[model samples]
Target: MNSLTRWVRGPWTNPTASGLLIALAAIFSFTEGVNPFSDGHAEGAGALPAALIASDLLMVAAAVVAGTPILIKAVRALMTKMIAIDLLVSVAAIGAVVIGQYWEAAAVTFLFAIGHALEARTMKKTRSALAELVAVAPDVAVVMRDGKQVEIPAAGVEPDETVLVKNGAKVPVDGVVIGGTGALDESSITGESIPVEKGEGDEVFAGTISGGGFLQVRATGTGADTTLARIIHRVEEAQDAKAATQTFMEKFSAWYTPGIIVLALVAGLVTGDAVLALTLLVIGCPGALVVSIPVAIVAGIGRGAKDGILIKGGEYLETSARISAVALDKTGTLTEGKPYLTDVTVLDPALDRSDVLGWAARAEAGSEHPLARPIIDAAEAEGLPVHGLPERTEPVVGMGVIATLDGQRVSVGNLPLLTVEGIADDSGAATEVDRLAGLGRTPMVVTLDSRVIGVVAVADRIRSDAQEMIARLHDAGVQKVVMLTGDTQRVADAVAAQVGLDEVRAQLLPEDKLTMVAQLKADGYTVAMVGDGVNDAPALATADIGVAMGAAGTGVAIETADIALMQDDLLKLPQAVDLARRTVNVMRQNIAIALITVVLLLAGVFAGGVTMAIGMLVHEASVLLVIVNAMRLMRRNEDQHSAGPAPASDARELQTAGAGPLS
Candidate 1:
């Protein structure tokens, strides 16, 4: 019995079946001298003939084949005391058939069925990005167990287990490399096509493909616990959640279907015209209204996902479009989070460059500050002797570090540490600090036996694309670009000038950064705060939109940020803003198209020019149009606006003004 029911309902779901039925019905109607396009005026010319009996039988078969699903769905809805578009369509088609309008009945049901099939097909295309993501989910894992390679289901791998990733293989779990080296094509997670080099201690995500080279990774997360899983979960949730406009449209549709039925009954009773009543019911299917917002939201969000930009939901997309000011953290956002040794000034010409650098490297050998890496790395690179850790080390909370090496007191820190240590600057060390600061370098004064020796400076390199990103933001309609940092005023000013930031807030603690974001919101500016998502959590939460950069490897950032950029590229930021604006525009345009179609169709029905068949055709056409309009978002290159390059004079002026504050 179940097989029989499936066979019966299959024709209703297939567009080819409906098309064949419509073709057969047209042939029979033409041979019997019944004009299917007469708009229901054939009632006067119709006559029963023995030869025309075949045409009536064919029309009845066409109606049954095309209307079965609608009738079944309407019956189910009626059992639940709900009125839907299917119920209205079923009533109209069945009523036309009962009133002896065979051509009208066949045309209405066949057109409705074919239209629904087309809508479903086009709607799937709008969601193709998400479908592609699901298709790429890893299935198998190669693990090293009992000293032998074992193949198992990806979900069966235990945490902390060693997994072997081979060339051109999909990584089965999120893990940290423990041995060997390779480049990974992280496009699945980060949307970057360039392969990223990975080595010992570098994190790799599941679903990424290893480019050439072997690697032994210690699994940190497996199955649904991986970052890829979180991104997939978030994207599915975002697509399923309803926007405010969608909620309104759903409620309106609920009332619309029932209201159409009531209007049809009243018009039939008062005017005594059954054709007019059925025509009203046919036109009021709510076809376009029900799908307008969801189609646009799905397409827009899916497009973002394909590009490695994960927007939280439709509501966030709407908010991102109105962003006027963008707040960026200086250290990890605008500048490379890693600092490098950029300048070395010898205050005492008597001491050589190695002597000055060796002392600073020795003092910093025991410290683990971010700025310490560049100094240590430079010392090691130049073959300076930094053999072992210092004997004793004390970190001054806000200043620097004091280390005792071989019972010799060595202090390396800013001028504040010198003041606290009572070291006089009669050697003109302060002059060197100011000069390095003017160039955007973090200057540290090295002291030995309470005497200033030399100054060592480390500066965070400005990203090559930083200026271009800021310029693109301006082109994307951003009113102001501001830099918020905890660095000293002079250092912040220099970096800000180099990047062309309109405003700079330096020496900010974490709480101070949060307050600055709140102040911007209070000032009525729609602000978007971009950060690395760890130390900047508070400010990120306070801003209108929190953007997490390079979030593919971090689960927390993927779940928390309003917008997560999978890669660490500054250019994706402006691309996200542009996408959001374009998506919201599409949503608004779709809604307008849907509503306008309904009003015009309703007006045509009352004017007595539209028949039941014509109304269904027009209604179906509008739904297809709305879906096609949303599909426009699936194509990249919707908006080609980009901030090309910064002018040389503008860059020079910023550098000049930026240097003045530090000098």
Candidate 2:
């Protein structure tokens, strides 16, 4: 019994069968141009001028072939206590048959079946991107177990196992290259066309193909824990999720289908025109309108996933499109997050660059601070030995470090550290610090026994694509690009100016960043915050959209961020924004197409021009038009980064983005 119910509920309807039946019906009807809707009634009971019996038999057969599934679906909807589109199509087809309009019944059901078949085929194409992604999942792995290489299923490999990836082979797991070297075609993971060089200690993900060279990777994650699996899972959930407009359309379809049935019944009772009433029912499926928003959203999100941008769902996509202001964290996002020794300026003239750098390195030796490494690294690079740790190292939060070396007080810190130590710098050292900071270099003022010696500056090099990202944000219709950093105001301003940022919010801690985002939202700006997705969690949660950069290795980043750019490339941020805007544009276009088609069809049905067959034809055409329009998003992306300024966003729907989903 259960098997029978399931079989009946499934897509048991075959449009091809109906097509063959309709062809025979059209041939036997002997009407002009093979029109099936024409009745071939005989002049007399004994006469055979019309060949009426044979024609009616073929038409009824076609109607039964097409309408069986519709009736089954309509019966299921009745059991579920709902008024579905199938119910409307079934009722109209049955009504035509009751009134002896055999050809009309066959035509209506045949057109409806064909429309569904076309939608199923085209929508499958729209999802081709995701299907391609799933197809890339690694199937086999060569693992070094018990000191011998053994082949096994990809999912059977255990964590921490060393997996071998050969040239032109798929990487079987997300791991680190502990030995060997290779380049990977990470286009599946990062959407980068060029294969990335992977040396010892470089991270590699599953689903990437090796271009050349062999690599032995120690797996960090296996099976569903892999980044590729996570991406596929996220995309599947996103496609199934509904957008705000799609939800509204569904509710509208629910009542609208029933209302059409009610209107048809009233029209038939008042005017006694069964054909006109049946025509209304035939056109009242809401086929295009019901699908307009979701098909656009699915295609758009699927397209982004192909490019390694993972948007959470419809709400984030919609909100991302309205992002007028973008807030960015400084470290790791704008810059490389690794400060390097850029300059060493001597203020005392008594000592050279080596004296200043040597003292700074000795003072900061073995220090874990981000700035300490650059100074120590530079001193060693110039053959200056930094063998021992400083005797005493004091790290002042948000200020530079002060350490004691060889019992001589050595201070290597920003200008504020001098004030904190009550030390005097009258040797023109502040002027040198200003000079270096003005050029976007973070200057560390060096002091020896309360005497200012020289200033050694180390700055995190801005990413190569930072400037391009800022410009592209503007081109994508973002009105403002702001920098929020814990760096001092001078350093922040310098980086901001070089990047052409619209605003800079410096000296902010993690919580302060959240307050700033909330302020932006309260000011009626749709704000998107881009960060590392961990330290910036508060701010990211408070913004309209939270974008995680370089999220390939970070599972939490991929899972939690509203949108995750798999690579560290800054250019993907602007590309994501551009895609979101394009997606919203497509959704609105589909909506407009659906609404216009409905209005036109309704007008045609009420006027005397449209028959039941004509109404079904137009209805099917409109549904196909909507599906075809959405498929445009799956086309190859244009130059989204350098495109002209985009259309202004609608802030009304996204006003409370920081609070929750699109209102």
Tell me how many residue pairs clash in candidate 1: 0
Report clash pairs, candidate 1. Answer: none
C-alpha TM-score for every candidate: 0.91, 0.91
lDDT per residue for candidate 2 within 1-663, as digits (tens), equals: 698686554443567677777777667666534345565353235654354566777778888888887889889988988888888888888888888788789888888888777776776777777898889999999999899989999999999999999999999999999998888999888877789999999999999999999999999999999999998888888887877878888888889998999998999889999877888888777888877788888888888888889989988888889999999998888776776777788877789888988999998884666667778889999999798888898877656678888899888776777888788654887788667666767677888888888888776666666777898899889998998887767677777766778999987889999999999999999999999887899999999899999898789998999899988788889889988888889888877877787778878887778788887888888888888888888875778634542222221011100100000
Candidate 1 residue runs with Cα over 4 Å from true position: 1-14, 39-47, 75-82, 638-663
Worst 10 residues of 1 by lDDT: 654-663
Q: On residues 1-663, what C-alpha lDDT tens digit does candidate 1 reach at each position? A: 698686555543544566676677567667767664453434456665543456666676778878887799889988988788888888888898888877677777888787777666666777787787777778999999999999999999999999999999989999999999999988878887789899999999999998899999999999999988998898898888777778888889889899999999999999999988998888878888788888888888888898899999888887899999999987767766666777677777678789889989999998866677778999999999998899999888667889998898888887878877887663888888878778777778888878888988876667777888998899989999999887778777887777789999987888999999999999889999998787789999999999999898788999999999998888889999988888878878887887787788878988978778777788888888888888888888535433443444322222211111121
Q: In angstroms, how far off is 291's CA in candidate 2?
A: 1.3
List per-candidate RMSD values in Å. Answer: 3.9, 6.5
Off by over 4 Å in 2: 1-13, 31-35, 40-52, 391-399, 402-408, 416-425, 641-663
